[model samples]
Structure formats: structure tokens, C-alpha cells
Target chain A: MESRPTRRRFMEWFLGLGTGLLAVFYGGASALALWPPAPTSAKLQDMGPVSAFPTGKPTFAVYTAGGAQDGVFVVSQTSGPPTVFDFHCTHLQCAIQWSSGASEFFCPCHGSTFNIDGAVTGGPAPRPLHRHFAEVRNGHVWVGGLSS
Target chain B: MSRQQGPDESRRPSHLSWPEWWAERLGLGASWREALYHPVPRRSSVFDLLGFMTALAFLNQVVTGIILMTFYSPSVAGAYQSILAIDAVPAEHFVRDLHYWGANAMVVLVGLHLLRVFYVGAYKRPREFQWVSGALLLAVTIGFAFTGYLLPWDQQAYWATTVGTAMASYFPGIGSFLQGLARGGDTVSGATLGRFFTVHVLVLPLLLLALLGLHLLLVFVHGQSKVEEALPEGYRAKHRTGDHSDFPAGDFQPFWPNTVATMLGSALVLVAVLVALAATHPAPLLQQADPLNRANYQPTPAWYFLWIYQLLKLFPGRLDILGIVGLPLLSGFFLIALPFIDRNPSTQRRKRPFALAAGAAAMVFVLGFSYVGSSSAVGPTAAATTASSQAIAHPSFAHNVEPLLTASCQQCHSASSHSGGLVVVSYADLMKGGGLGPVIRAGDPADSLIIQALNGTSQQVTQMPLGGQQLPQSDIQLLSNWIAEGAPDN
Candidate 1:
């Protein structure tokens, strides 16, 4: 009678242990499925040179990579390196137009104003126009669309 | 016999001379006094002191919250400034840091207490209501943390509150309602801050205080439950044979000396820990809020709710309505109704499969959501895109007029379908014009629709692009150069 009870007790202990282990393992897996890591890089293609855009002027260009139009921007240069800024306003991502006489990037969608260097000059833009990194390579200028 | 009775009655204290005097004046029966002064078992230890420490932590929150409210302003223009002023107070930084670290410590201590209760099966039998109330208290603590998040009104606070309110909006039919309630309007602004202030200072604290009172009352009435024993076979046999009672009387010391000492010790340890945390890593200061700037905002919710915020982002827009609102509401409702759902007498972690499962799931979900949300905040970096010299050398006809049209007039005049029926797809079509006449007068770019749009002098119902997108100096110069260069199409 003692042996029979011992065997039953051992079995119950084993079952409980097994279930507890299983519960922890499944719970951990479920948590992992909920959160994922952020992406590191966005791909952008070369458009052309500083001279091609001309000084004291903004030129609108379509950004296409791998046969897709990802976004559009107005490329311009003032004193230093040529800068490319997204035509979209920072507030709502609405496309902005260049008003030559006013010398700023203006978003008609919400009346946001960005100066020649993409800094917020007036109105509702939360920040300066997002300026992408531009580099001069082999006499050709390239602007990267990633925000640092 | 008469002489002996008279002497005995004279010798006794007047307050205890009769049963009526004892019951009414001293306010205690003989049996109740015996129980109150009863000798307890010797198994009680320092680890059990966590309960009292948890209560003290809640009290600390109430005290610090009151101090903070004295200086905090809920307005958008003043909230950030107010926090700065608070930080500038004498020993204000230390106090703020302590409060911040104390809040975090409370969460950790409460969680540890719950774990201790669960392991010892304290949630079983008559103590079940206490267990349920403790859970509600835990939820309210987290709620306090959430409401306190937006008080700073800095970039981090602004965005964090935005994401938090967005998560609140994921609750089924009441999702939008909760969102509005959280924001006090359609968007997060000054009104939202005021509403959260009321909740953090008034609503949640009151609820927490009431629940805490009930929890302490239950503990006093029931006393501590006995810790489960690991009975050997022989002990079990004896128990089965009625040689031992199934329920052992809980071993505990009196509330005055032994228990209170342990409680005080735990509170001291918590203070030391908070001091260390505040000294080592104070809360970070961020840039002041500027309504016109939002480019580099990296908003993250408090650690407690990060998982929920992360979870909501996992669902795509198509499934957002359900993923964001429906499921969280159901879970919250279930949490509130947990006592009713769990009617079982056994509170053993091993026996309560459903409760244990739910707890484990919640833990995992929170961890996962936090990981994902943090990862997504950094976003993707862009690869270098070099401009082609070849394209510059052989400038297309499209480039020349494209800048002029896109810059000066694309805002109000779309190329695809003209606003006011004036399409400017090509130079010919532009010159042909719409209701207001030709956009470009051939070689005379000065007197043409091009010049009119750039100067904002057009009487075509509204200004070009109507309100803004003012042309840069360089862009205007480029337009003039192109026009002066005989409007070249090369």
C-alpha cells in the first residue's frame, strides 16, 4: 500500500512540473511575437550634379529606386554643399512648393513655411524641412534621403 | 460571605467592576483580548515585510504627487516652463528624482509582493478578496504612471502621451471615447494635460486609497494564512489518519513590535534604493517644446506601458480597429472580473492553471511589445544617392519648364487636372490657358501667366497654391533667368 501511494505521488509531481515548464516556454514565445526591432537604412538613388541644379534656384526632382517613385524633393544650393529637402511638410507630409519671390518652401496644404535651407521660417511646420545628406562624388552630386 | 464580597468588589478597579462597565468603557470582551494578545508561531520572517513596504510606497506617491501639483501647470505654453521651474527649486531636483525612482520602486515591490503571495498560496480561501483588491491596486499604480507621463510637455512627453492615448483608443466601442477622454479633444494638447492631471491627482489616488484600506482591513480580520508545508509520506499518512489537523494556525508576531519593525526596515531599504537610483541616474532633461518643430522627436512611453504601445503598432491599418481597441478592452474587462471568473477554492500556482496562464501571457506580451516598439523608433537610414553628371550635361526639355511650373504654380494648378479648368501640362497648353487666359505669353515670360503666378498677382479666385509654399530667392532667380534666356526648351 505504501509503494502504490509513492508511485502516484511521483506521477503527480512529474505532471505538474511538466505543465509549469510548458507554460513558461509558451508565454515567452508569445511575448517575442509582439515586439520587433527597428530598421536601420533606407535606400536612395543618385539624381545629378550641383551645376546641373544651378545656384540660387530650386529644382524639383522625382526620387526613384529599383523602378519605383518613393518620394519627390526640391534640390537647391545656397553657399555650402547642395542640399535636398523633401517637398512634404513635416506636419502632415504634404508636398510643398517653392515660391521664388518669397525665397521659402511653402506647404499649401497647411500653410507651413520653410526657408531656403529647409529651416522653419513661419506657420505650422513642426521642424525644419527634413534635410537629407548630400555628397559630391566624381563631379556628380548625390543626396541621401535618410534622416540622421 | 457578605464581608468577603464587599472587600473583593472594593479591591477591583471601578472600570472593570461589572460586565456592563467592562463592555462599555474598556470596549473589549475577555475573549477578544485573549485573541489580540495571543502568542503566534515562530515562522514569520523579514521577507513577509514586503506587504507593509508596499503600502508605504503608495503613501509616498500621494505625498510627492501633492508637492508636484503645487507648481505644475497644465497649459501647453506653460507646462514645459513649469517643470523647469520645479526643477530649479531648492532640493527640487533631488525630490523629483526621488519621486521618479520611488514610483518605479513601487512597481517592483508590488510585483514582488504578488509573487510572494502566489508562491505561498496566500490568495486561497478567505484571503481571496485581498488578492483581488491587490491586483486592482497594481492596475491603478500603472494608471498613475501613465497619467503622470504627459506632465513635462517636452518632446518626449508629448510624443509618449500621443502614443499612449492612441493605445487607449484601441478599446472596442469605447476606443474613440477613451481617446477623446484622454486628450480632452480630438488631438493631444493642453486639454489632455489638464484631464490627466485631474485623474493622476484626484481620481486614481482616491480609488487606490479606498482599495488599500480594504486590503489592510482584510489582512487584520483574517490574519496571515499558513504557509503550505512539503509533507512527506509519513506526515501525509498521519494527516489522513486524523493525527494532524489539515489547517494549521498561521504563525505570526503581534502587529506592534515584530511586524512593525519588519515594515520599517523594508521602508528604509526602499528609501536607500531610491536614493541610490536618483544619485546614479537622474531623469534626463529634454529640449523645450516648440510648436513649429517636430523633426527629431523620439517619443517613447513609460516602461510599464511600452509593451501595449508596441503591441498596437504591430497591426496594420486594415486590422487596427480591432487590434488596437477590441482586444485590450476585453482583457481589461476580464481583469476587472477576474474574482468572479476564478471561483476555485485553490489558489496554489500549480492548481490555478487559468490564472497562471493569464499572468504568464501578460508578462510575455509586455516584453515582446517593448522590444518591437523600441526597435521601430530608430527608423531606417538612407543609402547615398549620387547625382549623375550625364543628366546635367544633356539637360532634357522637361527640366527647363518643369521647375518654373512646379515651383511657381503647382500648388493651385495641378498638371493632371487643372484647378479652375486650367491645365498646364505642356508649354503649348500653358500658353493656351484656361478661364483666366494664357499661362505664358510666348517669349514674354514677364507679362505671362508664369510671372503672374510667381508674384501672387493672379485674379483667378485665389493666390497660387492659395496660402503658402513661398518661393526661395534662388528659385525665383531661376525662374527669371529661364524667362530672360528666351524661355529655352533645350
Candidate 2:
């Protein structure tokens, strides 16, 4: 009996201690990991002077903020502010490209096409491309904030 | 095991032996050996040496670890510096090498020891807790390795840990939660480094000490199990009793000088080998850990962990939880519960065919997996190659802007020297504009800030080299041509 784990209650207490310590160690780490996400300070991107974008054409403007790449189609065809569509396609989330000949936005991956107004035109795209908050001020095109 | 000696402290008088001079004075010495010592089974051989090998390796690790602790710093800024400082110690070069070799040896010996215990059916019946404690000690040893892997803060340590912790996030139901727990926060940062140091130096050491104590106590109390016994059948018989005295007394030998000699010889040989290896090939140190610069890195786990890494590769991405969490946990649970489940006190290899085969198969599998993992292309290297190739298909700021910017503009337009509040070091910074306005205007060189500045028509200051020669007209045209091409990044 002496050679065995005969002290049953003592064994249970020891097991409890082991379990408790492991629990605390892992539990504390999990809690720390779940802390609120840090706030990012991404300032608005001022693309360029208004004259840089040809007024009658679909001029594609690309910019990066905080190492993340984003693009917008700044169309100044009419008298109003330029229409800015986010470069991400409605299908599969790949960055979209401009087709100067086709006069439409197309996904390089799945061939989803959209009209200049961001409306889905053909392919398997379910909806129009997302847009960004864009405005023309002081002869420059300022693109800021997502409007998905 | 004696205390008294001649006038020369190192030499013992020929007339006085340990039993006469020492044991007579310390009257309880007989009982002391009787209490602490045990009889070695007649069948004992080099195979039973694994237990001693593991213990000696552990002792080596403890000595080296304590020595390292005197100099190692726990903070992120100091971790790499501390290791470098340790290496810079004059004439005592092999101290760090001993720790590295000690850890590797401990891992190898512990695994071999476990296999010995398993093949002999030593976990059966009364020695169950010995097996349990041994299993737990195995885990703590591996814990020591895992935490220690991150101490140097080098490229291997940083990226290997990144891949390892990312693998942990594949557990079912609590996958991401467990990952968060291990990582401290979302990514491997200062917090993770500090905590892993604490675990490696303090927390794991304490746990290992306690578990080792328990393991040793259990071993001595149970006495080295008799591996010669094998029941007629592979099943336990009812009303059977365990009595150590029933074995023939002559078949056992007192473990005074015999076992002690074996332990000393084995320890000496292991240290000699380790020293030779360490002196020839020292450990490595790569570049410091930087999360953003990981594109060039190809992370791989340590050798012992390569089997699990290979297992993860074998499974689909969605079923990763099975390989990562389920497989190891299930195997651990089975080993822990083997005493209760098997109940067969058969030390004969033939009668315990399943147990022997299973152990052998596991060994083969782990070695095979490690072979595959080591020989294969580095993890994430293929994906990184594809991404780099795709990047090459587009316009590049490195090729276009870097030449003009470094020669004509880097003197004033840099991260350190952001004169005019403009930095052309990165495309992102170039697009953020200067004190006056944004720089390059895509598709229109006429309205570009950089082009206009070079043309020297700005309101703020002179831009055509305040003191140096103006950039040639051809160079200015090249810059204009790049802007007129939409300024796409490669």
C-alpha cells in the first residue's frame, strides 16, 4: 500500500493543483489575445491635380496607405464630381483593372465586367463594384474611407 | 559514498573503508542505503540505460540553463543582445553550445526511455503513476524546447514560431482561441517574446523540477519494474498479487557500484560526444525578427517538430485541426491511459506483439515524416515565389523612381531627411504629397509635382539644385515618361 498512490484525497488535491495552474496560464493568454483591436490612423489619399486625370477618359488612379494597396477609377466625364469606384471586384475579391478599349472595369481572375457607373455588366458578378468616398477639392482628387 | 579520509583530504586511509569509518559513525547509514537503494534485475543491460541517460541529460540541461540565466535578459530589445553578449565571453565559448546540445540530447533520450518503458509493458498495474508522471515529464521537456526555441529572437526563431503558432490556430472549436492564448496577442510581438522567455527560463524550469521530482520519487518507490515476468496469457488473472520479495533473492544485485558505474560511464560518453559536436559545429544566428520583412524568409520548425509539420502538410487546409490538435492529443491520452486499458503484465515481446509493433510503427512514422519535411521545399516558399513572379509582371517603383530619386532627390527627400515634407523613399510616401502638394500625377507630366519642381516654377523655394548642377533634361524626360504611364507599382 505504501508503494502505491494510497493517499486518495491527497492525489485528488495534487491533480487539482496541476489542472488549476495550467488553466490559469493558458486562460490569461487567451484573454490578452482577445483584447480590442488597435486603432489605425490612415490619412486620406490626395491622388493628384485635376488636370492629371484626362476629363473625357476613364483615368485609373492607384494609391497605397499603410502598406495596403487600393485603387479607384476617377471618371470626370461629366460636369459633376469624379465617380470613384473601389478597385476590388464584386466577384472573388481580386483587384479590378480598367479596359480602355472595352470602356469597362474587369476582374483579372474571373472576368467579371462592370460599367463605368459600377453596375455589373456581364460574367458571374452578382452586384456592382464597391465605391469609396471621393471628392474633388483645390484642383486635386481626394479619395478617403470605404463605402462598401 | 564516504566522508572520512587521511591527512590528505583527497586520499582515504587504507585501514578505513566506507562501511567501517563512515557507516559506524553515521549509524543510520545501513538503513539509509536500504531506504534509497534497490536491487537491479538480473536481466538488466544497456537497454535499461535510457532512464539513466535521460536523467543525466536533464542534469546537463539544468546546469547549463542556470549558467545561461545569469546573463540572459527577458526583454525583447535585450534578447538578441544578451545571446551575443553570452557568445562574446572570453575563452569559455562552449557554454551556449552545451545548453543547445543538452536540450537535443534530452529530447532524444526521453523519447528512447519512453519507448523502452512501453515495449516492456512497464506501465501495467502498480506502476501506473510512474508511467503517468513519465508522460507528463515528457511533455514538460518538450515545453522547455518549444519556449527555448524563441529565445534568440533571430530569423529562425521568429519565423519558425510564427509558422508554429499559426499551425496551433487550426484546432477545432477553440482553434483560434488557443492560438490567441499561445501568441499572447494577435501576432508575435514584444509581449510574446517576453512571455516565452519567462516560460523558458522560469515557468518551464519550475514545472520541470516539480515533475522530475515526482518522476524520481515514483521510480524509487515502485522500484525498477521486473521486465522478466510474462503471464501465460496476455490478460490479467483475478486474485493475483504483486509481491517484489517473491523473486529469487540471488537473481538481483545490490545497486551500489554496479548501476552507479553504468550511469557515470554513460554520462561521460554523452558529454564527450556533445562537446566534440559543439566544438566543431556551433549553433546559428540569423537576422533579427522583423514582421514586415518576412517575404524573404522560409520558416521551418525544429527537427523534433518536423513530424507534426509534415502531418499538417499531409492533410487538407480545412482538416488541419485533425492533424494539429487531434492526433497528438489522442496519442498522449492513449499513452496516459494505457495502464488502465492494457492491464496485461506481459513483458514478453511475443505475447505483447501489438504493443511492440505499435511502438515500432510510431518510431518509423515519425522518422519518415521528418525525412519528408526536411527534404521538401521550405514552407510558404512556393507561394512566395508565385507572388514575386506576379509582382515582376507590373511596373516597378524600384526600377523607375529609385534611380532618379536616389541620385537627384534622396539627398533631401528621405525618411530621415524629409525636406519640404516630401519623402520619395516609398511610393506610399511619394503619393502623400509635400509641404505644398502631392508629388507625381499619373498620366500627366505637365501637372506632376516632381516634374514641376524640377522645372523650377514652385512658390516655396528653388528646386533646380540650390547649389549643385541641375538634373539633365533627358533625366527629367524619363521621370515624366514614368508618370505619364499611370505610375503602376510592380
Candidate 3:
């Protein structure tokens, strides 16, 4: 019983509303997928016993927080406090391995070398390896990967 | 028609007569074909083909850019990840590579076209506006390059844009305004990226399209200007013998086949070159940026802006404003106004001293700056090391020293916030030092950190910041005294 233009306007309005809702859903999904809510602070797990990392030598340990591997290499000095470092090289994300003979954490990918304290000692590395915040809790060593 | 259907009526379909069917549907009859083929003067040549191909390249950029934009995140954290996603998407790599190469090729082709127009005297008479418009288009092309540089949000993009925005800050009174406008705020951050993306994809594209339309319209309206030729005495006599006509059609061909062939051929060549570039030398990706880390940040401007960057560096800090902004603006204005300003009727590059000098200077400056800027490190390492040593030596005056160190030395030696890899902000970090070795030599003041830093005697890999500002005499003395005091942690 309504005029032709009025009916057409109502149909157009409904169509536009439907399109807007569809776009919002899709865009929101894409944004969420691209940037998942990463935790501000990830708790450190108990990465084995203290003797597992020997004195005056470096040991590699892998810890998981929220199902992601946070690779850490811990070096225990003979007479000083133990220093822990993220195994990822500063130049690129290549995994660094401990070379006792060379006395450094060497990255084969770009020849970047890190000293015992996780500082860059040689080659193309731009910065020292990142330090993992660690604490001795309940006679076990726990390391936090990224700070809040 | 009275006896039986006429030939025309019989030839028509049974449902409708030719004129009735045409008029009923299109509101026009069969007479439209005559108007459609109406002859227009043809002054275009193979040289004119570049403009058409440039248009086609822009269309490709638009299509590819839109597709890429669907996945692109204009955030510091998400920008690099989105690029990785684009690479992973099936067949998206080819499109992205094409867009990248197409942009570079468009700049090159436009440059050549402009040079050709200048040489052939096409900027004379009524076509001067087109010439000026072409100059603006060139600026827009460079603008596109600048905006696109930050989309990756890597260290290279960040530092490069930092240097670029800093250069923009040299524009007299409006310099800071333009710098803020370019960055969308005080510093390069999320807002800057968003603004750049919007301008690159939307605002600039709209302006380009409008300007290009005007350029083409003017080009068509005022036919290509011919090179001035010396006439022989017999030529005028021969012209008198023959019929004189302003409109000549015998030498020209139809626009359909010839122009299309030329345009298509150039486009094919450009596509082949772009494909070769894509297949052989894929664009390199640097490491993801960390806000807490800036050890290996190398700031290199896009190839087009390298010359200005280099020029700015050559000039002292006092004249940086003139070198960075004023000279470039004056040159750009002159280049755009060349057609109007140069009353000389000749179009030869050799004959145009001012234009030739400007062009040569620009080319040389850009090439030189790009090479130097890319090779140089972010800041002066020696100066930073000295400043840090001085600060450590004079812990009694740490408060006064901190600000001075940060302003003059933080670019290379400080790990305060996101300045650099080396942490010289505190006495402890200064003693710990950066890649070059400890800035403190413990209990040996004479053989201390300041001496080692100033002489670059440390065996640790590359020396501090490696390039940039040099240290002043007072700062050097301060470092010497600090090292002389056995590099105290206090």
C-alpha cells in the first residue's frame, strides 16, 4: 500500500545494513588474526635442576610459555653469578650454539659471536643477545623470556 | 514500402526496424558512427607512447596495491608480518613484485619522457601548463616513493624516514610544520604509518589522476610543438607554389592501430624488465624492529632522496636548512617554470645552460648521496664513546652530564630507551660498555676506557657508532680526565 520509492528506500537501507555488518565481521576477524593478544608477561617455567647446567660451562635450555619456545642459553661462571641469554642472535633470528673451544656462542648463519655475558664479541651482530630474567625459586631455576 | 517491405525494412530483424530499435534503446540512430570517426589532428609519435604506458602502470599499481592493502597492517608491530603473509599468499608475490618494479619503472620512464619533451621543444606556447603539470607529477611520483618507504616498518624504513623527516625540518619557518605533517606527529610511529598509507593509497592517487587528466587534455589540445628548423630560401618559394594548410593529414596515421601498437610495445618491454628484476633480484627484507634495540640501525633514504640527504650532511648544522629544503625547493620551482621563464626559442639540452646544469647537479647529487648515506652508520661513535667516558669520569656532575651525553652522544653510545645498542646511560652500563668493549678500564685511569675509545684501540669488532658527528675539544678533554681517574663507576 506504500509508495514505490518508500518501499525501494526500505530495501536499500536493509541491504546497506547487511553489507556493513558483513564488512565489520570480516575486517575484525582479519585484524584479530594478524595481531593476536600476546601476553605482557610470560611466566618462567622450572627449567630442570641446578646441576643440569654445570659450573664454568654453558648449557642450552628450552622453555615454553603459552606453547611457544623461548630458547635460553645459560653460562655458569666458576666464581661469579650465572648469566642467561636468549639463543637468538641480534643480527637475524638464527639460533646460536655454544662453542667451548671458541669460548663464545657462535651463530653460523652470519658469524656473529656472543661472549659469556651475552654481549656481542665478534662479527656482524648489532647488539648483545637479550638477557632472560631469572630467579632461584624453591631450589629450582626459573627464567622469564620477555618482560611486561 | 506500399507494395511490400522495402529492402532496408526487409533486411532488418522482424522484431524491430533499424532506426526504431536503435532510437528506442540507445536514444540515437545509425548516424552516431559518422561522429565517432570524425578526424582529429595527429601530432603524437612513438615518444608519446611512454605517457600511455605510465597510465597503464599506475592502473596495475592500483589493483595490486588494493589487494596488498587487504592484508597490510599499518602498525609498527604488524607491518612486517603482513609483508611475510603477502609473500606466503599464492601468486601474491608476483603481484607485489610487479607493483614494486612498476613503480620504479614509472619513475624512470617519466624522467625520460620529460627529457624528450624538453629536447623537442614541446613546452612552448600553449603547452607550458602541461610542462608544469608534468613537473608536479614527478614530485608526486617521488612523494609516492617516500610514503611507500615506511610501510614495511623495519629499522631501515624507520631510520630512512627519520633522516627524511629531519631534512623536511630545514624548510625555514614552515620546515617544522612540514616535518610534523609528514610524520603525522612529532616522531615516526603508528600515526605516521597510517597517514603515509592513506596518502599513498588514497590522497596522492586522487591528485595524480586529476593532474594526469589535465596534462593529457592540454597535450591533445595543443599539438606537440615542433623543433625549430632553419628554412632554405627555396623552401618559402616552394610553399608559395603549393597550397598552404594549417591542418595536414597526409603524414599522419589513424590513432587506433599505430598508437595502440606503440603503447603496447613499450608496455611489453617494461613488463619484461620488471619480470627480470623480480626473477633475479628479489627485494631484501631486514630484521624486525625492536623498540628496545637499535644497535645496527642504518638510516638510508630512498634512492631519489639520497642526494638531498648527502647534501644536508655536507653542509654544517647551521646551513642544514638551506641545503636540505631551500635549494631543493628552488631547483624544483625552476625546473617547473623552465618552459615559461626561458624566453629562448631553442629546446636543445646543450643550448639550455641553466636547465642542463640543474639536471646534472640533481643526478650527481642524488647518486652521490645515496651511495654515502647507505654506507654510513647512524651516528658518530667516537663522540658518543668520549661523552660516555666523560660522564662516567665525572659522576659528581652526573645530572649535568646526562643531558649533554644524551643530546650529543645518545645516537651511538646510549641504550637509554631505544637510542642504540650500547648502554652508556648509567655508570654500570658504561663500565659494561657496548660492542666496542668496556668504556671503563677499572683502577687504571691513565690506561682507562676513554683513552681506548678515543684511539679506537679496542680489539672488539667494529668501533662505536662508526660514522656521524665528531667530538668537540671540551668533550674529548672530559673523556680524558674520566679515563685518567681510572674510569670510576661513581
Candidate 4:
């Protein structure tokens, strides 16, 4: 027997469809809004002149722009372009120290050690220290975002 | 029609009876009356009041949380200042303190409620779903704790959150995704604060309310459980299909007068405890977060999580997964599956001796671990001891302080660079000061601009070594002690 759809059943089906659509729309919207947005392209921050950094010595080069301060270690090699290391240690993101005596970078927080090339030498550091996108252009060091 | 013919209504014009009119349209009053008038076991003791007390504690949290939202600014730049502003006013500070204490109270009350339920074997057979819902409530309560912790925007809040999110990133496959989702970026910043505030205020509250509604509905449907020994012999088989009305009608009394009085008393006691704690010991707000000074601050989890914090220490490096992921999952599973796992229908404590013993041992372990975690030194305490002990009795301006400055500060503040119009290259140049003022005073380290900059305490001046890591405590102490000894060329 063919059954004719009543007004009550049709209304119930319509309401269910409306609710299903609303759930999908709200859930999708929330997920889209909450997911971390892609990082924007970073502006290059100037870290003083090439002459400020001495060869084989890692010096703190701080950049202050629009009142926000950020820093990096500019290690000027004897012959090659200077390499800039991120200020924070890879182990747990504490500031790393440069020891003139040992010529190694040490994380004061957890005792992780990194050599001049930013390679992890000892302690609980998971990997090598991260380097920033750096260049010595026009005799001044400019650092961009950290290398991927 | 004079249909409403009660003796109470006889004194008034029955046509304009507002209460009766509203109750007719709203239509929930009858059900509410019925629920309130339901019967409960006559000997319902103080332990039966745990669930009610927990709900009251949650209500207090909600009220205080709403009050806090009025003053709290979600942005990173304004958050710390807003907190300081709140703390400055005595009344506001008391409110904040109450909210702080209320959160801790909620956690404690919920845990106690769970324990009381577990001990009585109330989470068996018919009440299995209730136990599952209660377990989820526990998780939500903890979620509230974690999300609220970051709102203060202090050093303690920032670094603790940093370590916490980092731990979350250790989960097997979607670790990085979870970390990014929680942080709203690669790091804990303003975005993270915004996310936490939204969750703490909006999302979690809604979820908790829905769960609470379901939980309370189940409780009202089933009524309070009888004491383990009070159950009849064929209790399980007899009550398998809702045949028994709530519990055996031996000496059962109306839930209104019987349980309501006890709950109201407990609620009053909870309020007194919160007030006393808030008045005597106000909440702490540490210095504004300095990401660079992660070396200085020690980040510890809240007291409820102290056991897990200790567990992380026990299992280090690769095995950190065990403490962070494995244990929480294991405990959660055990809680949810408890009713099924212990299938013995007998609810008496003596009959389930092994289960009871195991639970007791777990309690001891948690308590012991929490004690150890509270005392454990996780940060660079070794550095602090050395720095304090070696606080140069007579620090030389020439030998001790000058060398330290030349290494760390002179790069930007030298004669040629002079980024801050301050020069630290020579002793004479340092006295002249910079763009701010005289960098040093003869015998006042506390008032000296140099000390203020180095310690990052001056609101007017930027932290010295600008974007770089803060000078080590020993180095800062050397300079301060030198200035105190009266700036002399030794």
C-alpha cells in the first residue's frame, strides 16, 4: 500500500533537515575560525652594521621596531657571511648563553650545548639550533623569520 | 470563570491572580514542585551532600568569573596592566581573590564528590551513564583550570602555559596540530590568550551546562543511592527495569526538607571557607611575562596537577609520553569502565575488598607524588644559589662591572652607536647618563637608571640589552653592588 505523506510528517522532516544544515554550517564555521591562521610574511628587522659584529665571536644584535623588541646572535665568521642564530634554545625555548671560554652556546635553563655552527653538542636539546633568514646587505645585518 | 478556588486565593480577586496565570503559561512549576517533593532515603548522611556542594561551588565560580570578565582585557599588551588595575582597588581585588579561590574549591569539591560516589559503589548497573558523565565533568573542570590560568598574563602564566602546550605537542600523531590549535600559533601570544578567554568564558560553560543538565536529570530520575549494606538481597534483579520507586520505601522522607536543609548548610560553609581564604591570602599576580627570561622563572602546574608534574620528572625525555599521555588515558579509561570491570553486583565494601584496596593505593600514590612535586626544584635553582652566594662584597667598577657591561650592553650603548643616547663604554660616559637620565647615582643602586633598565622594572625605559636575554642575576648584582659601594674607579 502506497502511503500519503501527512502535514505532520512533512513538517517533522523539514525541521530535521533544517537542524542538520544548521549544525553542519555552525560546525564548519567554527572550525574555520578557530584553526590557526597562516603566518603572514615577516618584515626584515635591521640589527646594526657589519662592523659591529667581530669575527668568530657571537654578539647579541637586538632590533626594536614599533616598540616591540626581538634579538638574535650574529656570529660573524672570519671569511664567510655571518650566520644569525635565534635567541631561544631549541630544548625548551630559554635564552642561550655564549661562553668566550668554551666558545659554545649554553642554555642556562636546562644545560643544552650548541657549537658555533648551531649544532647541538650535548644535553637534552632535541635538534640543532634554529637559524634566522639573515643577510649582510649594504653593510648592515637584516634578519627575517626563522628558517623552516 | 472563578476556577481557581483555593482558600489562599479567596482573599484576593481571583481573575487577576498573577502567579497562577504565569504558572499556567510557563508550565514548568508543576514538574519543579514534583522534583522538589520527591522522596529520599531517610538516613541520607552528610556524604550525600557532596554532589549538591559541588554544584554550589560551580555556581560560585560562574558568578565570580562573570565579575572578573568585566575588568579583564584579553589582549597581551593590556592584560597585565588591567590585572594590576584590578588588584589596585581593594573591592575588585577581593572579587578576583574570591574567583581564584573559587576555582580551587570547585576542583576539590568535584574530586570529593567523585570519590564519595566511587566508595559507595553508587556507579553500578543502572547508574553507569551517570558515572561516565561525572568523569567528563571532571575533565571539563580541569579544562576550566588550564584555560583560566593563562588569563593573568604574568610570567608564571606564560611560561607555565608554554611548558604545558609543549607537553601537549608530545602526543603521538596529531601532537603538532593540537599544539598549534591550543596556542593559535607557533607560540603562546595574544592569539593564544584570545583563544583561552573564549573557551573559558563561552564554549566550556555551554558544554558544562549541557552535561550538568543531563547529569542532574539522571540523578533526579534515579534518586540517591542506598548505603552499600542497605541494599536488599535481590536488589539488582528486582530493580533491573525501574520497578522499584527510587529506593526501598522503608523510612524514606521527602527530599525537600530532608536533603535541602543539609545542602543549604553545606553551601553556607563553602561560602565561609572561600571568604576566609580570600580575605587572609589574596591571589598572587607575578611580574608581566618576559619570554626572554625563561631562564629566571620556574613554571609549576596548579596543585591538582602536581602529581602529573612529578610523574613527568619520573619519566623523562622519550618516556615523557608515559606521564603526559599514557597515565591520563589509563585513568580516564579506568574511571569510565569501572562499573563494567567490577561486575560483582554486591555493593558492600567487604565483598569488594581488592577493588577498594587498589583504590586506596592509588590515592596514596597521588598524595605522595603531589607532596614531592610541590617541593621539587625544576628550574635553574643551582644558578640562583651561586649568584646569591657570590654577590661580590666589594664589586669593582673597573674590573667587575665594566667588563660585564662591555660584553653585554656596550654593543648598542657605546660611544659610536649610542642607541639610547646612553654610553657605557667608559666610567665617565656612564655617569653622564643617556636619553633617559643619569644612568647611575653614587650610592643608590635601587634608584639608579642602570639597575632599573637591567632588571626591566622601569616603566619609562625599555629593558636594557633591548631585545636580548636579560643579564644574568650575578652580572646585574655585580653592577648594583658596585653602584652601592659608591661608584669609584678601583
Q: Cα lDDT of all candidates, in order?
A: 0.61, 0.68, 0.62, 0.77
Q: Which candidate order results from sorting by lDDT in descending order?
A: 4, 2, 3, 1
- Error (Å) of candidate 4 at residue A62 is 5.2
Q: Write the per-residue lDDT of candidate 3 for residues B274-305, one digit (tens) a residue.
A: 88887666665566753222232324355555
For model 3 the local lDDT of residue B399 reads 46
- Show the colliding residue pairs in model 4: none
Q: Give me candidate 1's interface root-mean-square deviation.
A: 15.1
Q: Return the TM-score for candidate 3, rounded to 2 decimals.
A: 0.53
Model 2 lDDT per residue over B1-490, tens place: 8866667754555787765466557775444454333456555667788988888888888888888888888767898888888888843347788889889999999998998888877887678998888888889889888888898888778766766675565666775566656766545666678778778878877887887888877765555666324222321121122223433356655466766777788889988988887788777777776453212344567889878866765554345557767899898898777788786677677898887887789889999999986665344334223222222233346774565576557778788988888888877888788888787788897888787777676665676555544443334555666677787664
The CAPRI category of model 1 is incorrect
| Best candidate according to lDDT | 4
The candidate scoring highest on DockQ is: 4
Where model 1 places Cα greater than 4 Å from the true spot, the runs are A1-148, B1-41, B44-47, B227-252, B290-293, B347-358, B368-490
Model 3, residue B315: distance off in Å is 0.5
Ranking by TM-score: 4, 2, 3, 1
Cα lDDT for residue B84, candidate 3: 84
Query: What TM-scores do the predictions have?
Result: 0.53, 0.59, 0.53, 0.75
Model 2 chain B, poorest ten-residue lDDT window?
B231-240
In model 4, the Cα lDDT at residue A3 comes to 88
Give the alpha carbon lDDT tens digit for every residue of A29-118 in model 1: 854542322211255457776667767666676554333233345455565667777655664343466654445566532245777778
Worst 10 residues of 1 chain B by lDDT: B382-391
**Per-residue lDDT of model 4, residues B1-490, tens digit only:** 6586678854545684565566566775545544655555677677788888888988988998888899989998999999999999999999999999989988998998998888988998788889889989999999999999999999878877877787777789988788879988766788889999999999999999999998999887665677324555565344544344555577765557866887788899999999999999999998898655534554557888888877766654456577778898899899878888988887789998988898899999999999887766344444544344334568776666776777788878887899878888888888899887898998999899888987888888878778766766656666777788898888
